[model samples]
Target: MYTFDSFKEVIASSNKTDWDKLKQVMTIIQTVQESKDQALYDYSETFDNVKLDTLEVMQTDLESAYHDIEDDLRAALELAYKNIWDYQQSIKISDGEASELYQKVHPLNRVGVYVPGGTAPLVSTVLMTAVLAKVAGVSEIVVTTPPQQNGVNQAILAACHIAKVDRVFQVGGAQAIAALAYGTETVPAVDKIAGPGNQYVALAKKMVYGDVGIDSIAGPSEIVIVADDTTRADFVAYDLLAQAEHDVLARTFLISESKEKIEEIQRKVNELAGEQPRAAIIKTSLRDHHYSVHTVDKAETIDCVNFIAGEHVSIQTKDASSYIDQINTAGALFIGDCSPEAIGDYIAGPSHVLPTGGTARFSSGLTVNDFLRTNSIIALKKESFKNMAPGGMRLALEESLQAHHDSLACRMEENK
Candidate 1:
């Protein structure tokens, strides 16, 4: 594990490989744009090692997957769906009304959700993204994922059925993003795309931002556990390892003022990591990105946490809830010892798809708001138009937009 005396040194040491990957993703997207639907099949053979006859998953297959999933798994998906749907419903934007100005919120006509399925099937992601889109009343919710040797995972299909996704495509990587953005013979174009995946998919989303909306260019999973002498070493260790197991590039940080407590947490992390099923990944990630920082006080610790701007932050100190307001940047915050970061990933009311790699400073997690667009409404009576037109005409004339000024003048005259 690496030790940092200051958060500045940690930021300096961080490695960035997005630009290199962006070049490769751009090449793949260009190929997809040229080949259209054929590129998806070619990528499947090259990356997934499968020859596909059809690009879309049929409705019958989704029904079979629903039945094939075990009873307990179905129950779990239903529960997650309920929580996400309920939370999204409660947060719907209220229609604004006033004498001269109002606002209307409307769901996008279509949206595409990508679920990572190469090494592991991210079934939870299906619930986290699609359920919110459904609750937002999007007309169409299309899904895309990489296919396995046989096909897409049954659990993923079952989750799609439960989430009421309109369609599914057996495709992934930059090519899938291109298809969603530009449309093809089979995959209809979508207004926006949401979900997380590897570097390639992230770069693809970044590349296609203007053509279609995206949630965020999500980076590797990360977590920062802020604890002190009162914190439980075992809990801190396991949570760190849980984040580390996400990928070989995942990062975990421990911030505290007590040297002995840091050492104890590090020791527990080493011992518990060996017992995890993804021990190899956990070990590599820990050696590469893990950091332990010793701070002078709570203020310094909070500063370190804000600088890291981790995707998930778990505060395990005394009165953890009190620290929530102090944190200025983080994708998600878990207060108190009883709330584990893993719970937020799986069953929490908030969507698990969050900004990463210090992007929490500007971006936010996925929500029903992502699926809806707001439009400003303007309606003015003759008196209201007379009251407001001169100011607008003055601004338009100052900018030398003669057409804009003329249009406003013409309307005002007609009203008169």
Candidate 2:
């Protein structure tokens, strides 16, 4: 069982920013920028250790992917697609307060989604990123995933089909980010790049930030479960492992007022984690990243939860919904016993692409808002224009922008 530590100290240690990796990541990005598709071929051989005949997966093969995958998976993907799109549509473009000057919403023309082909194929990510873009009316959505020994995963292909992703590329890592940002012969330049990837891919996104929009500097997946006496130790244990199974660095924590309750959950975690299929991964993840805290009271527990700002927060405490407003930093909240973070990861309406690394303090999970850009529309009436011009010209003159003031003067003169 894991021992409880000083919550502040444990949270501080998790901030592992690798500035050294910047140079190497930049080199990979530059290589793709210069070599284009041939660079993709070389990197495929060098990093992925798989040779590729073509950069893009053919359209026919993409559409036929549904037939190749299992019937259950296809059904699941289709259902998830509909749910995700529905959620996105619900939150989109509601300028309830009509004004003469309002925002004009427009979706990005194209986006590139990077699906990691590592430990798991991340088939759900296909729906999370692509379908949301589709709902936002993005013209084209392309996906980039690393290839496995047997080519792309059939389920991933099936997901692409279900999500209606326009293009699928067999490229990944920093090179994939580079190719997406600065187009290669096969992969066209995208307006933005979405989806999560490994550290190199994350660093590449950081490098290409200005050239193309990225969803976020995604860190490992995490979940923080707050339990009370009414909470089931087994449920908390499994939820902890749910996040732990993601990666060795994935964070999990149990915070409760009673030390006995925390200990019981830890004990349950030990018993359940070993029996899991990803038991080896779960063990490593817990040993490396899991933390425990014993809060003196409800106020202390709330403070701890806000400080961590976990990607997913599950409350099993009594009257959980009443405490929702107190914890303001979580990326997604799973309230009550029946609602779990795992549901949010899959069938839940919202995108599972939430902020990690305590960034939920300042950011939010992916949504239709992330895909939509807003432009201020100003068609000022003569009265409003006259009202604003005097102040605007005065400010422009004070700021030493003579041309700006002159332009406003010219307009005013023409109107008179």
Candidate 3:
């Protein structure tokens, strides 16, 4: 049971809501900041409930981990790895080699990827982040994830093998970010850090952003569905619930012009929810932040969708692709009823780590783009500099920066 709202109210309230709690994570530092080994050990004891003397995962352990995993799950992980790797490789490019003009394109020498470890081993995440770094031509990629039980999950080790991570560490949470940013004895400092994690991990990355590059401080997952009369109630309900199951904080919304469709979908959702083992989570998420809106027409539905700026958006109406073209914001667009949100999560070939909490309005889903950095190349001949000097000086003069104007003025005099 969700409530409807006009776009204006939602926008205003979202802005006014307290974000201070979320901001605090960036400020909090792990107790192990001074010593990487101690930090890892402390977090291991604190979060994972295990104390370990060694932080680095040995290759022998990795090999044994492969045997530890079931064959079917291993096959599934391999399939996911191949799909993700194949897709990322297509986007990677070698720098425009030997250009006459000053040009340079290259991957960072080192990068770090963080994978969550706790409730479930996110084997797919290792494929998503590490594989992309390799495709982007990074020389070295390292993985940092918490230990589960006593050690890394077997699936996680196998994924690391698939991702070709140069090093693996059994550390997680804020301390992991700090170690990657500052460099522990076993973990070398990386130029950039990428991947998703819980609140503490997210906050740590936010805090260490200036010290090292990081992906977005992702918020809870969210999905918004724009369904028409042609939409199946079951399809709409299931798709919305996919993101909702991520966490209770995750949000889901459905906007339709037809009141009957909205009611029918709600009924279907209620019926299906009872069967879900995670039903309580879904129910609370829907009851709290989720929305079911009855718009006046398709125009209003589009407006509502844009305002929500959901991480995943599905259009179950006719001309779904055309509607996607019309929509300005959304992390990922699933057109038509057949392509549900579930496909995007595991095997869709697109990275499921998307912008969340309305960040899709400005940011984007994770991609090879996130793993690559572009440096602008610029050069000017003596004549070019002479020609541009007067304009540069005039702007600097307008801004009342005498030194800025003088640097160009002196350069022009030297050319003469």
Candidate 4:
């Protein structure tokens, strides 16, 4: 772990776009574009070691998934769905209209949501993206996930059902992103693509950005906890360990004014990591990515947080709530000791799909706005146009555009 005396000493990469993966991702995308679903099948077999005859997940599969999951699991997912849906409604924006100018909000015709199918099933991801799209009133929501032995995971399918996803495709990785960006024979093209995936998937999204809108190029999961001497060492250690378990690249930053507190948390992290199931992964991540920063006071702690702009910021100081407004750049702020970063990953109302690699500096988490498009309207009467023409003509002439000047000039002359 690196110990930094000041926030300026803390260093982080702003954009984590892997240019090295571009060549491989480009090849996959090109093959998908040429061979279409055939490439999807071949890649699935090559990577996932599964041979698939069909690409789409049928309605029967979804129904079977509902029956496959346990009653308790289903109930938990149902509650999470409602919570996410409620949060989305609370923050959704409305259309505005006036006498002459207005903005009309329309949902995209169709959208594609990519959910990474790794060792553990990402059921919450299915709910996070698809539910937001559904709330936005998207005409059709399509989900693409890595194909399993049966098809998609049962829990994930149950999530798709709960979110009212229009369709599901048994494809993942770069090829799935390619299929979404450029329509193939089976997988239809979508207006936008949103979700979290591995490096290949992230690079593919960057490659196909112009072809389709993407929520954000999500990086490794991360969390920053600003704890002072008053903070609980166990709570701070637990939060940091949870972050490291995400992956080898996942980062954890602990900023505190007290050197003794930082040392206490570090020791606790070392002790707890030994007992964790994903101990190896967590240890490797902490060894390489973890940083225990020493600051002069609480203000310096927050300054370092804003500088890093981590995905999750858990303020565990004496009065954590007082610093929430000061943290201008976190993807999501957990403003107390009780709110662990894990809660936001699942049961919390906000979508855990967040900007990483210091991208919270500019981009935002997935929301209804990602699926909605707005267009501005302008309508003016004769007097309104006449009143506005002279100013418009002056600027046009100053730019030496005679045609622009003539367009407004002729309109004013005709109106007179």
Candidate 5:
């Protein structure tokens, strides 16, 4: 299905625009304030087709959901919770003490987590955010999601219950974000918000970013597989499908030098495509964004992979571990065929929520660190301040800030 375009051609085509939907979504966000809660309700009916009564989910409903869920599914969710806890528990940093140095680690007082609700209930995402925040020792953790026609999804409620979230709110989209950011009559303001959602939610997060803290304004899901002759073509095809099924705008790519390998994977993609339930979405996503490169050499293939810097990078080359050492970007790197991108999305310890749209170049995936902020704490004994005053005054005067120099000099004089 991939064309034999040169490197530049592939890059150019990848940057091509289909901005009609993006523009419309932005307009919806811009017009949100005119209606407020009513606007969110309208979008729920239009986009999610679910009408609402009370906007917040209750504990009674959550307990009922936990009890209604099958024991097997509950067990699996519990296992995932344990795995995430074990991984994130290791991220603890001892609260730094202040002596002479001016750096300190401080935990945020409260944090809010948003879980996607429309199309599918993303119960696993609840685990991803809550576990990481809890590990960071955030004092108050709250969860927000849209209500379904009947009520909040049982699985999502169940996940919140297991995580022991301090509060659960029935809210979504810009209104939910605005509530968390500004604090309305019912919802409380939070220090940070983290999760994944459709474009409206993304734009809303971008809008409310400065008012409150956020993990990132995440983009659509992405996966880039670096494969060679050693990789099984079936595995490659399935890995691409795993990310592509996430959204219509999701991007998936394969970088390899072997023509036979590319052809085999393409055939497998077609065969597998026929059997998937989300075939229509996956097919459109593949046709629009998926491709295979016939790189000149292995080094060239690695260079090509780095340029993409996808949210998820799967290394299935002959020496995948060695290649992993060479690459410096990507939200998360899957070492071998057994570590599929899908596993990381659910049961794997690391966060499935990651930076996207080439942001892995600087930003990182969600972790306990995202929920906490570091403060710089500094203090000096009276004698130390007296000794350091002359140098500090000299620098302040050198910069022409006489007020700064005078303040230190005056303090030193008073001590003397």
Candidate 6:
């Protein structure tokens, strides 16, 4: 059912949409715009099945969360924090040394990070987003997530504590995005918003793009694995299943030159799917979204992989590193058999929040750079100004802007 003759066919067939669903999301965002805090409270009750007195997570609750978490989990969170912080620090923009014609990078005044919470707690997302903002020297980092009947997940709260988040609000979905885009009484409006969520959240971000900056409209998780006979079928199968379990919409692909290897991997996938805890989700994802392509050679496989432009790509060829240079359009590349996508998801020193739905062709994963804004420095000395005045005047005249030419002429007269 998932067979494809060429990469072009695969690209053409990647459409997944329902206009009615998007319209509903738009209506909800509009409602939030009208109602503000009341809309948030109503949505929390209607969708999340929780009645809340307040939208903000209290400071006492955050402290209790840190104390509530087990020692081992805290240690793991600390290690992840260190690795992510160190990696971000290493790549942070340094002060411009040039006297002119340079750019100065500075952190945003405030940012909002959305961590998804409902069935499961995404504590890692809290670290993946907030830690980068902290390392980028952001003055304020506000966190917003869906709350259970009791409150926000303790692990997420603990992560907030570790990342030194400035504020946490128990709100989610499109309403949460709307709240962040337009300030409510409880949640302060953010300069930019970052993090992943369901389709409604993605649409809300799309609607609010110009009002506030957004990271990306992330889709479901996806991975493409290019393997040869050397790669184990079981390993490939589990890798595909791992991504599939993320959501019923999540997709996984196996591209190989050997038909025999592809068959073996498919068989292993069926065998393992029955054993997974989230087997229903894995089954639906595999049935609807997963594909195994058989190419004539490694070159064709590589081209197909590039066309897919997956969020995560695992190359299990003889020399995995050899293919890295050719991989021009992937959110992240897992080089070898040992390098599972999980490593990058957890402690691989890169943010797991990546561009999805083939957006890797242009965009990239989340990083400290996303938290920064660059201002171009144009410091023209008197000599440089005089040298460029003639050209500036000529261009201004060519464009029929007398005022622009006069400004340059006046500056030249001052030099004279």
Instruction: Give the runs in model 1 whose Cα sits over 4 Å from its true position.
Output: 1-5, 13-15, 410-416
Off by over 4 Å in 2: 1-5, 94-99
Q: What tens digits encode model 4's per-residue C-alpha lDDT throughout 190-263?
A: 99999999889988998899889999988788898998879999988889888998889888888888889899
Taking all chains together, the TM-score of candidate 4 against the true structure is 0.96
Per-prediction TM-score to the true structure, in the order listed: 0.96, 0.96, 0.88, 0.96, 0.91, 0.97
- Candidate that scores best on TM-score: 6
Model 1 per-residue lDDT tens digits across residues 317-357: 98788888999798999998889998888887799999999
Model 5 Cα displacement at 285 (Å)?
0.7
lDDT, residue 180, candidate 1: 97
lDDT scores of the candidates, listed in order: 0.90, 0.87, 0.79, 0.88, 0.81, 0.89
**What residue runs in model 3 are displaced by over 4 Å at the alpha carbon?**
1-30, 93-103, 393-416
lDDT of 5 at 356: 83
How do these models rank on lDDT, best leading?
1, 6, 4, 2, 5, 3
Per-residue C-alpha lDDT of model 3 across residues 132-161, encoded as one tens digit per residue: 888778899989998767578888998887
lDDT of 3 at 392: 97
Question: 27 in model 6: Cα distance from truth in Å?
Answer: 1.7
Q: What is the C-alpha lDDT profile of model 5 across 171-279, one tens digit per residue? A: 7776677667766556678999899887667777887788799988887789988878889999999888877788888988888888888889989999998688888
Winner by lDDT: 1
**Candidate 4 least-lDDT 10 residues:** 6-15
Worst 10 residues of 2 by lDDT: 1-10
Per-residue error for 128 in candidate 5, Å, reads 0.5
**Mind sharing the TM-score for model 3?**
0.88
Clashes of each: 0, 0, 0, 0, 1, 0
Candidate 2 per-residue lDDT, tens place, 1-416, comes to 23234668657876876887878899888888888999999999998899888878877787788898778878888888889989889987854345769877888899999998867789899999898899888999999999777889888888998888899999989999999999988999999998887788888998999989999888888888888888999888989999998887788878888788888998898888879999998999988888888887888888888988989999999979977899999999999889999988888789998888889999998888888898887878998898889899999999999999999999899788
TM-score, candidate number 6: 0.97
- Model 3 deviation from the true structure expressed as Cα RMSD, one decimal place: 3.0
